[model samples]
Each structure stands twice: as structure tokens, then as C-alpha cells.
Target chain A: MTPAAPALPPALDILGIAVFALTGALTAVRMRQTFVTAAFFALITGVGGGSLRDLLIGAPVFWVRDALVAPVCLATALLAWFTPVRWWQGQLLEWADALGLAVYSVFGTMKALSWGVPPAAAVLMGVVTACIGGVIRDVLAGQPSILMRPELYVTAAALAAGLAGAGVVLALPPALTWAIAVAAGFGLRGAAIHWSLHLPAHGGEE
Target chain B: MTPAAPALPPALDILGIAVFALTGALTAVRMRQTFVTAAFFALITGVGGGSLRDLLIGAPVFWVRDALVAPVCLATALLAWFTPVRWWQGQLLEWADALGLAVYSVFGTMKALSWGVPPAAAVLMGVVTACIGGVIRDVLAGQPSILMRPELYVTAAALAAGLAGAGVVLALPPALTWAIAVAAGFGLRGAAIHWSLHLPAHGGEE
Candidate 1:
């Protein structure tokens, strides 16, 4: 059987992997962990959600098919470990994270669609793939997960994925649908970050 | 088509759920978290690995089909929260943990076998399903996972699962095979806990 082509361009996937690795390394740094620990964190953050998604969907050769993702994660981890604080405290990292979120969300949805999952399930899978790494990172780092926070994270992902799925249903071109999804995800997430917008808190006492 | 009967006795499954839930509640207490956090942890610990396994095998109505699991988890969490530490500590908790590890390991292996997974994969799944909850709990509590430690934890589960798989290959009675596997797992874990025997630590530079 012919090998399946990747759902997204190599460049965007690598960028997303690198950004996630940077985030994981940053988390390890905050925890005052060693270099190896930081690398392990970065590796998991880059691939954990996607690994789970593939395993659930019974994708063949789950990790091996993505040649660029691991190397990018490793490089980013090393860079994060060696870079000075002043260099990292910039808007570039934030932008990279937004881009990563968008790319990963779209890619995740496309993979689910390829698996022939229903549209609703595909959208849910997209959100899970985009947010699960961060959720795992927070949980492992002993911080409250973003899911537990009154945040717009899941909502943003859902909106992005819904748009993409709708595009698919409407028979829009795949490239155009992906572009629209990525843009929407990035736009909403960037706005949330800029405006400090969050979901309304529940009133019940803990 | 009629649904396949559960592989084990309903009471045993319920007992396993309760034990895991109790362990999770105790962990939450150690972390000094609120009741909600305790409940959440307990529920996840009781059901997380099994839910994951079912999803991977494409089992329908994964959590909904298991009626006893959720209630047992909730009940055990409530019990642990209310019970005095003096009453719940020492041998009582240890015994419960051993039984839970054994039962859950066998349950996982049986499920994997029914799914026609290879023996090695089934054993791996057994160990993962039995122990992933504790790993998740430790990670959430910001401690090293049991798997990362030099422990006999996974070894015991693997041995038990291997024996069970062999029994199946030889066409031995299923109940007898399950009993042997459970005994091997629980016995080894109990002995290790009693004797404080563990795998040797990796030598680190001073």
C-alpha cells in the first residue's frame, strides 16, 4: 500500500513542534529542572497529544511518519535551555505559540477527517489535539490545567474546528478550508491573549 | 447482536474501582487539595486507563456500559475523605492497593486479548492500564511517577500478564488463568511492599 501523504506542510508542522517544545522547556525552567528533564518535557509536549490521537485512531507507524517533528522539538529544547532570559522575554515566542496552536488545530482536524470520523467527533479531536499537550504540561508541572481555568481555550479551538468542518461539508477546497481554520484559531487566541478575555467563572463555592 | 459478557465478576470489578478511588483520594489529601479536586482525581484514577484502553480498541459506549465503576469510585472517594487516617493507613491501604493492581492488570490483559492484540502488546496494555492512574496522580502532584522509580511495579504486572497469556495459548480455563495472574501480581507486590525490595537505583554523579 502507498504511504499516506502528511495532512499539512512540513514547515508548519515543524514550526508547531518547535513552539510546543519551547513552551515545555520554559515550563521545566520554571520548575528548576535539569537540562535532560527539560528535553523530556519538550519531547512529550511536542508529540504527546498527536501520539494519543494516532493510537486511538489506529494510525500506522504513528511517530515514524513525522520525521521533522522530533528534530525540531529537540532543537527548540536545546535553544530554550541555552538562550538568555532577556532574549526569550519577547513577543516572538508568543506569536510562535499562536501560530503553533493554529497549525496543530487544523492538522488535527484533518487527520480525524481522514480517519472517517464524523464531523462532530473530528472537531472534538481537533480541540483535544491542540489543547491536550498544554493540559498535560500543566498537570505534570503541578499547575492547574487550562481546562480547569475559566479560559476561552477550548472554545477557541472548537470554533476553529467547526469552521473547518463546515467548510468540508460545503465542499470547499481543502487548502482554503485549512487556511480559514488556522486563521480563525490564531485570531481568537491572539485576541484572548491581548484582551485578557476569559470564560465566566461559575458561582458555586468549591 | 448480544453484548459480550464482562470478563470478570461484577463484584471484583467494583472492588477494583473502589480501591483505586481510595488511593486517589489519599493522594489528594497528601496534596492538600479541596473536595472537588479529590473527587476529580478519584474518578479519573478509577476509570482513566480503562477508558483509554477501550477507546484504543474501538469498544462502543466505553464508559457508559460499565455501570458499577463510577458509583464505586465516588463512594470510595467519599469514604476516604471521611475516614480517619489511623483507620485507613498501614496494612489496610496496602492490601487494597495490591488487590487493585492485580485485578486491574488482569482485566486489562483480558480486554486486550479479546481485541486480538498480540501477547506482548496485551501485556504492555495490562501494565499501562493498571499503573497509568498512579502515574497521572504522581505527575499531577509534582512527584516522580512510580514507573520512573526503581520499583517492581511494572515487572509484577508484566509477569502476571505473561502467565495469563500463556494460559490462554495452552487452552487452560479462563477463570483459573485469571486467578493465577491475580495471585502472581498481588503476591509479588505485597511481598515487595513488605520487604521493601525494589530495583536498584541508577547511579548518579555526586
Candidate 2:
């Protein structure tokens, strides 16, 4: 079965990579790491999960196959280093993070579907591809994974992938499905960040 | 191609599981975690990767399918908690670890080959299954992975798996191949742990 490509504009992909790289650099700054270490972290955070997924699926890794990603990552790291804005500042970084989440979710879902994985497995791949990089970054930086918190992060990605997969199953046009899914993810995450929305605490003893 | 089953008695499997669980518990104690946390860490470190591999390969997870593994793990954890000897300093624990590494590597390779994976991929799977549980434990504990260290752990597993795969290709008797492979792995890892052997550091300044 031919995998349907998502209707992602090239600009969206580039934006996603750049934003994730910036987040990585910002995380490094918080950890008081050197510039080279920051850059290395940024690159890995931008591409690591996709690389692992590609290796597992026997697909040509996009980072190795295409030269554009590396340069974009480096540029983003440089930008993060020189920015007057503190990495922890709420507004700009949050928006960038939301955008990255949306785009990465779509990209991951599309890639997994292309590999002929079943819809459920493909949705799993999508969530993993979008979130595992950040999880790895957090682990390396010795912080709890965002998923461990009562955040809507994984939930947002899951929603996006589920919608995309549903659309595919319903025979919707690929472009329309992708656009709606990405919008749904970005919209939900953006609102959560803006309003500080979160899941209710379980209040159980740890 | 038929995968080779280890000639080592089933008792070794029980012993390996117990020792690894003890190691996991000791490591958790070193972190000064709570009992529930320690037990969770022990269980995951004892079985997570192999369980994941079984799920992927459509095998009944040994822990879930067989009645013995859970009891063995629970007993190991209890022993670690109550034993007068410091778990970390126990010589039998060291021997059990070596034996576990050998048996698990052989078992992982055989399972992969049974699923008809390519030999190289089977070898990779073996290394992943044998060592990934420990990696997951270290990551959760905020320690660097064994793979990041200049260690002989993964290398030993890979070599054993490769030798076992070669034996399969050469049509050696399954039992003989398993015996030799297990010995090769156990001897290498035991010597490394005994002598503090490690790979030379790489990625020096160019």
C-alpha cells in the first residue's frame, strides 16, 4: 500500500525543526552547559526520535538523507544563544513549542503510515516520534519527563494522530485530514499553555 | 531457520532473574527511594526489554505466560531487603549477573531468528533485549546508560549473538551452539567485571 503523504508545507517542517532545536538550546542553558554541548543537545532533540523510528522501520533517515535539517538546527541553536528573551519566558517559547508539537505529530503519523504499519501502531509511532525526543532530552538533563506530569502534552499528540488516522480510515482527502489534525493539536496545546490548563491531580499517595 | 535454545538448565533462568532483580533493588536503595518505587524499578529492570521484544515478536511474554518469573522476582527483591550481606558485595550475585547476561543474549537471539529476522538484525535485537532493561533503569535513575560508558557490556552481548548466529548458519547442533555462545558471553562479561576491562574512549578532540 502506498503511504499517503501529509499535506505539510515545507515551511511548517522547517519551523518545527527550528523550534525544537531552540527548545533544546534553552534547556541546555537552564542546565548551565557549554555552547557545543547545547548545540549537540539541540540537534539530537530535533532529530533523535525520528532517527530511531526510521531505523526501526527500515526507512532512510531524513536527517541523514536530507541536508537541510542540520543547518536549520544549527541556526536555531545560534538564535537561541543570542536571543534577549530568556528561555523560560512564557509566551514566545510556549507558542514555538506548540507549533513544534503539532508539526512533529503530523510528520510522525505520516511517516509511520507510509511504512504500512497498522493504524493503532502508526498512532503510537506518531506519539513516540513527537514526544520521545523531548523525553530523551529531559532524561539526559536529569528532569522528569513531561509525560510524567499531569500535562496535556501526550494527550494533545494523541488527539492529533487519532483524528488523522480517523480521517484516513474514512477516506477523507489526505491534505484536508492533515490540516485538520495539525490544527487540532496546535489549538489544544496553545489553549492549554495560555490558560495553564491541566488534568486534575489524582491525589493518591506516591 | 530454527533458533537455538540454551543447553543450560531452566534453573539458570530462575537464578538469572533473581540476581538481576536483586541488582535492581540495590540500585534503587542506593537512590534512597521508597519501597514501591524500588519494587517497580526492580521489576522493570528485570523484565522490561525482554517483555517488549516478546510483544513485538508476538511471543507470549515469559513473565505473563509462565508462572515462575513473578515469584522469582518477588523472592529476589525480598532477599535484597532482608539479607545480612550487602547485596552489592555478594559474589554469587556477580556470578548470577554474568550467567544472566549469557542466557538472555542467547535467548534474545534465538527468539529473533525464530521470527525470521536477518542475522544482523537478530544480533542487534539480542543486544537490545539483553541490555535495554538496564539502560531503562539507569535512565529512570538519572544515570548515564551503560552504552554511553566505554564498557564491554553491549559488546559482549553482540559477540555472543553473532557467534550463535554463525553457528546456526553452519548447521551446528542447537544445544552445542547455545552452550558455546553462553560460555563465550559469560566468560567475557565475568572477566570484564572482575578485571574492570573497558573499551578505549573515543571522540577525542580532532
Candidate 3:
């Protein structure tokens, strides 16, 4: 079950990684950790999701094979380190994160499908690809994990991945399919951020 | 460079997994989560380290390929769920965790070496396999991650993995090498548990 084409163009892929890396660096900076810790956090956050996907799908880890990825993460870390924390204060980072989440989910699902992972699992792989890096960052930072919350974050990724999987199953053009998937995911996440949207708790605790 | 032998015999491998699964299950039970949550926790914790190792080394994930592993994890979760929490409140579980940590570290290192990973990276892989599962569990449980603490836990796994990597480099007898590695690791962790040992903070904060 080969995917019709690559899920993301190279530039966009790098952009996604860079965006996630920035989030990771900012996280470390907020904690007042040193440069080395920020760089480590950036690298792990940038590569965490895709590496897990490739590993699960029996492919070489993407960053290990590509010389450019690590350097890019390090550069992002440097940028974050040199910049003052106040420069990044706002919803811009959150918006960037949403974009990264959408694009990465599509890329991950497409990659999984190409590797012959079944469709359902492929969708899950997409979620893993988009979210695991942030999860790792949160966990390592000792922050409350995103997984424990009932936010619409994972739900948005699932929507994107599910649509991407369906698009491939229906043999749709890759460009249109990815565009719709990313837009839908980004829209949902953006709305959630703007309105502070959340999924209802199990027992309506709130 | 193919390894001279499998990292562990089938029985011991399953035992290690079962022990880890028990810890994961107990964690969820202690948190008052549902049976499904407990089972999920058990499965992830049981297979997490090995899966990470295999993914890093580009091997098929062990539990995914094996039919018996999931059922064993589910069974362990059931045992944890059905039994009273008082039955497991002691050092016994900690000791079992140490044993699992030791055995899994050695097994992970040997497997990485078999996959032709470099000596140092293989040792790191060993630590990842032995510790990442519990880290994930703690992260999900909203507990202070073990990574954030300067405990001797990771140090012990590193010792075991380092020894295992060294033994492989020296072309030592596999059985004897493994026994010694496991004993050393378990001993360190056991001593830490009994004596409340800790690594000094960066600035001697303790």
C-alpha cells in the first residue's frame, strides 16, 4: 500500500520540525535550564515523533540518516537561548505549534501507510508522530502531561490523520487531501486555543 | 556483527516483561484508574523499553511480533486490579523493579550490540530500554518523573549496560557475562534502596 506521494514537501517538513524545536527550546528556557539542556530538549522535541514512527514502522530513524535535521534543531536552540523570553510571549508559539501538529500528523500518517501499516494504525501513527515529541518534552520538564488532559489537542490530530487515511483509501489527489487535512486540524486547534475549548470531562467535573 | 547468542532465554525474557508489567499495573491501580487504563498501562510499560530499543536498532518490535506478550501483560493487570493494594505495599515490588531494570538493561545492550550499534550508543540504548517505560508511566501518572530526580536508578542501569557492552567487546562468555552484569546492576539498585542512596546535586543542594 504505497502512499501516492510524500505527505509534506521538504521545506514544509523542515519548517514543522523547526517549529516544534522552537517550542521545546522555549520550554527549557522557561525553566531557566542551561544551553546544553535547551539544545537537548530541542533535538528530542524536533525528532521525537518522526523517529518513533519510523522505528515502529521498521524504517531507519529519519534524523539519524539526515545530517541536516540535528543541526537545524541545534540552531533553533541557539536562537532560543540568545533571545530573551519576553520576545516569545503570546499565542504565536501556540499557533505555530498547531501548524506543526497538523502538518506532522499528515506526514506521519502518510509515511505509515506507505510502510504498509494498516489504515487504523497508520492514523494512530500519525497522532504519535505529531504529539509524542511534545509529550516527551512535557514529561522531561516535569510538566503536567498533555495526555492526562481532556483537551481537543489529540482530537484535532486524530481528525487530520483520520482524514488523511481516508483520502488515501479513496485514492484522492495527495495535494488536495493534505491541504484539507491540515486545514481542518489547524482550524480545530486554532479554535480551541482562541476560545479555550476543551472536551467535556468524563463526569462533568468542570 | 551478529551476537553470539540471544540476549536472554525465552523464560527469563518473559519474566522480566511480566515484572515490569506488574509495576505499571500497580501504578494505575494506585491512581484509582479503570481496569482498561490499568491494562493499557501494563502493556505499554511491559513493552516500552524493548520496543524503543528495537526501534532504535531497526529490529521488529518484540511484543508486537510475539503472540504471548500482550496476554501476559493483561493478565498482570488483572492480577493487580483484583487484588487489594495492601497486598503489594512494600519493598518487594521495588526489589522486583530492580531485578527487571538489571536484566532489561543487559538484554537491551546485548541486542544493540547484535545490531551493530556502536559500543557507547549500545550502552545508552540499554539505559533507554530499562528506564523509559517507567518514565513514561510516571509521566502519565502525573508523578514527578524519575528523570528529574538524582536517584541512583538510572545510574544502576547504566552500570549494567556498560558492563554488558564491555563484556561483549571483550568477547567474554555470554552466560557468565550476563550473570555478572545483572548481579552488579541489581546490587547497586538494591543498595540504593536499602540505604537511601542518591547522587549529589549539581551544587550540593541536598
Report how far residue B77 has shifted in candidate 1, in Å. Answer: 20
By DockQ, who's the top model here?
Answer: 3
Candidate 2 is scored at a TM of 0.61
lDDT, model 1, position A137: 81
Candidates 1 and 3 compared by TM-score, better number:
3
List, residue by residue over B67-135, the lDDT tens digit for candidate 2. Answer: 466556656656655554353675777777777877788888887888877788777777767888888
Off by over 4 Å in 3: A1-7, A202-206, B1-43, B56-58, B62-135, B142-206
By DockQ, the better pick of 1 and 3 is 3
Q: Give the per-residue lDDT digits (tens) of candidate 1, residues A39-152.
A: 888988888778766654446535667676777778878888888756877878877787777777777777767766566556655765777788788877778876555556
User: What TM-score does each of the candidates earn?
Assistant: 0.59, 0.61, 0.61
Q: What overall lDDT goes with each candidate model?
A: 0.73, 0.72, 0.84
Docking class of 2: incorrect
